[model samples]
Target chain A: MPKVTRYDAPRVIDSGSIWILVAAPTIWAVHFLLSYWVAAVYCAKSGSGWLGGLTDPRWIIVGLGGLSIAAIVWLGMIAVRRYGGVFVVLEEITDSSEQGRERFIGHVALLLCALSAVAIVFTVIPGLVFDRC
Target chain B: MRRGTSILFGVLFLTALGGCDGRHNWMAGAGEEAAAIGDLFLILMVGAAVIWSLVVGAAVYAHRRRAHPGLEREARLFVIWGGVVFPVLLIGALLVWGLFLLKGITADEGDLTVRVDGERWWWRVTYETPTGDVVTANEIRLPQGRTALFRLTADDVIHAFWVPALGGKMDMVPGRETTLALTPKKLGNWGGLCAEFCGGAHALMRFDAVVMAPDAFETWLAREAETAQVAADDPGFQVFLDEGCGACHTIRGTQAAGPVGPDLTHLAGREKLGAGLYEMTPEHMARWITDTHAMKPDIDMPPYPHLSGPRLDTLVDFLMRLE
Candidate 1:
């Protein structure tokens, strides 16, 4: 019988863990579409009112955006702790080693997290400025 | 080859310059909102031009110059500073500024409300006053320096209401009402049209946005509210009824209570007829009645080809007298 190895390439990096790389951008896209649709529907149904009034649609958008940012931050933490992602420096992981591929994914995920956070902030701007429809 | 290219560019530039004389020019800055937007556009255009020149210049310099292996850190720094940092800062600033301008232009309410219903190829305008609603068609008159809130809605299909000299376009969707506010600062007949293509004769769908003094506007609105004063047994009135013109047109204080077409109570008082397609003249009116398709193809109004000679003349005379 052959002896079992201590590391077996981490089971091809697991399909489920790949989602961590794209979680931030996916959350951003969802938040953007949801915010726009909600505002349009609400404006069409009910006319313009005072800011922070009863019929204001900004509250829902802000709430969802906050929750999405929190989730992305959690994913970023996982990437840093387990996948060896560095915040300041981008790692060159072009080698064929399994550890290199994992670190590459983590680095890309970290960058995407920052980009998605910026996009989420941008998405919330229209609500902050426009008090009415 | 370079000389030929230069000549071609010159011709193109001249053509573009000539095209600026169009009646629907938004850069005229005839209204407060339009002027605000125009100023913002000019600033953005200058900024964009500067940025584009810098980027292209840098690209050309990089491509032509000899590369050194020792300058890797310099190149990376340049990419970070020029490509990433500059673009982020510029775009972020622009976004905030644009949002601020948008907030400034948009108003919750105005001094007066004018409900404009977008039809397939025409506008059904109604002025809501403290007394009552004054119904009109194809023309909008406002007082200079006073804001007018336009409550826009479409009956059949989607259309966009645009008075370029006045302000930006607003979509008129069916089953929903969209509002836009305009404060005209100039006294002129600015062209208004349906920006969104609906169906046939969409291009012919136009209106005259006339800005006047406050007193003049008040007088005109009051006069427009009054009913037409015509003899009951007039030959022209008989011809109008016989030709079924009353079925689709309304003449105030008369039995002609049709809701399909425009109200003809103040037809002669209008600056243009056929929805701003022609100057309001008796000759054009006669041609419009007989050769409706020739004037505006695929219009809802049928041509009165059979009614010629005295009958056509009488009908035209009656419509002309509807001031």
Candidate 2:
């Protein structure tokens, strides 16, 4: 009778998963730049004094910020589920296993999501406070 | 070695402290808007100093102190509180406060309106009065306790109008108009300069922002509205017309309407000549007429090197009497 051997190898991490780590921060950056650009261009093109109204651009900015935060929160939820439904910051997830690497990425993605949410909130403050162009 | 390093740092700190003189100081608080901005700057500076001290202290401790393996929880908490929570709260508050201040200062209208055009190496100023537009150059006079709205534009390239003691800077863009509102609270002469680098002679572009009392400002504006009172048959007037000086400069109530250079309507009444670069005197005026490049390099005014003797003196005298 021939001896039977079991083959075991670490699963390869998919490149598609890496985008989850940067998705939220990228949204935050895009939203910040877009808000500033819209305000600046509008003010420059419209000339001095009230053209349409300050509230028009303010509402647009608020909507953009809200959408960005919602996307970040959704990403955070996905990260939590993929990270074994636990948030770990004090311990390093370095077991030389594929599962451990995925957990590490998930934890980092969740942290980024939280940071992006805070940035989105900061971006919305200008729209709320300034009532003029 | 540590003692030497400490001494060096102390000297550097003292040197930095010496740079807090009031010239070009944004925190001079000479105006209402400037005072508001100064208050905000003071708060931000103090907060930044405290935050810097804490961050540097923690960094030093982390570098020198021995690691405690069991203090992971404390480390995580420190990151969350100091790195995450503190920054978010502080920056969010500051952003809101700054935006509110901006809105307050940029009021839509003011008591008076002044149009300032940024030229190559000077400022073309026009004050809208109840009678008519009183045109002047290189000098801005505002009444104390009254808000003045500045409608700024550039004739050539981009320039920035800044009177550090008054308020924030506003850019003068070509083909577009930008406005700034400021109310002078203190009565004094504040320095004004072009804060943007618009090629040659940008550094020489400057003006004097004089804050005067309301009655005095009214009197000055009244005087500025009248035409030049020089006699038509004056020899100096003849000399001014003969030298083709009228081709570039405009003197009100006379035929010297060229529109190529600053309006010399109220030249003698101004505090300085050559765009606030020199005291308005006969000598400097003569030099400016004879050697324009030496006074303000790259200016459009051609030097009258060929015209000398009593004629040059007469031209200078004619310009000085433009008040």
Candidate 3:
């Protein structure tokens, strides 16, 4: 009998949950597009930079980014529960069982979440910096 | 092998240093904004060099050392500090600095304003005076120590205004007006150009940003605003009219008032001819009229290959005297 730690202690593993791999990046992409759209529309509409230079649109982008990051964090939590720990110590995820596949998906998804979070942060920077079009 | 590598790097460094000189050097520090930009570039270069050295040095050190048991804690600390935090901080600081620099250089207002319209292969320059607008062509003269806001536009396709020694490039889009400000610190003919490729003669389109003393600039402007002193019975003036040159060219205070080409009321007074292509001499001026395509290909100016001998010589002579 295995002395199971909570890392591997899962009740019912979803057999094919590969959508988690793309979830974080998808959120990042959506946030990036929306951020750009908001800024472009704002600048184009008001040439003089009136109404305080993308202030309203910038806050909207911040809210969207916050929501996206939160969603990614939630996805990351799900990945962590199955894969174990923040650090991916696993060299390779070649496990073939239902649990093995779930672990493999979790491993890649966690990395994607970290990358997406970093990308989202970078996207928010230009909005904060530039005061005008 | 190490000696050879060092020699190779030395040669590369020297070669890179060679680009620091000449007229088109953006790091010339001829203007206040240009100097600020030059400082930013220097900082960026230094930071990059430092970062590269650290990364390579770490790799070399790790390579030379024997991997024994574990320095896991130290390694983790190194990764977090060197890999994550350092890059984040460096990029964040640089981004902020760059944004501020951009904001500073892109100031809309200035001590004075000059509007320049970019044509197919030339610049139509207009200086605002207290009396009225003083229009000129090709050459852009700026007063030293005074910030000149440039309102730029294009007649046909897209073009770009750039005085490399003074400041950055700004686009001149058709039907749109973009503004750039340049304050000259040095009194010299720092070369100006049309940066964006427009057509066949795009590369040939050039000008001189002549920084003059404020008083001299005022006197020059006053002179430029006045019309040319064309003699009523000048033979060259008669030839210019007979040849139908007035249909495309304008010589103010004369009957040859064609608002199509450059305002040649004081063409010879300018430093260069053929849109800053040749020296403003009789020889270049004569060639420009007869063999226009030879000097600058694909130009709108029709070549006067038929007109030659004394007629062409007289016309060139008359143009040179307008100064």
- Which candidate's lDDT is highest? 1
Give model 1's docking category. acceptable
What stretches of model 3 exceed 4 Å from their correct place?
A1-16, A47-67, A70-111, B1-19
Residue lDDT tens for model 1, B1-323: 99999999999999998866555888888899888889889999999899899989999998999988787777777887788778878888889988887665556589899999998788999999999999999999999999999999999999999999989688999987778889999899999999999999899999999999999999999999999998999899899999999999999977888899888999999999988789999999999999999998887899989989999999999999999
The CAPRI class of candidate 3 is incorrect
Clashing pairs in 2: none
Candidate 1 wrong stretches, greater than 4 Å = A1-16, A44-55, A89-96
TM-score, B chain alone, candidates in order: 0.95, 0.92, 0.92
Q: Write the per-residue lDDT of candidate 3 for residues B176-276, one digit (tens) a residue.
A: 68888898998888888999999999999999889999999888888888899989999898888998999989888888888778999988889999887
Q: What is the TM-score of each candidate against the true structure?
A: 0.91, 0.87, 0.84
| Candidate 2 lDDT score at position B281 | 91
lDDT of 2: 0.85
iRMS for all predictions? 2.3, 1.5, 3.6
Give the candidate order by descending DockQ: 2, 1, 3
lDDT of each: 0.86, 0.85, 0.84
**Model 1's TM-score against the true structure:** 0.91
Candidates sorted on TM-score, descending: 1, 2, 3
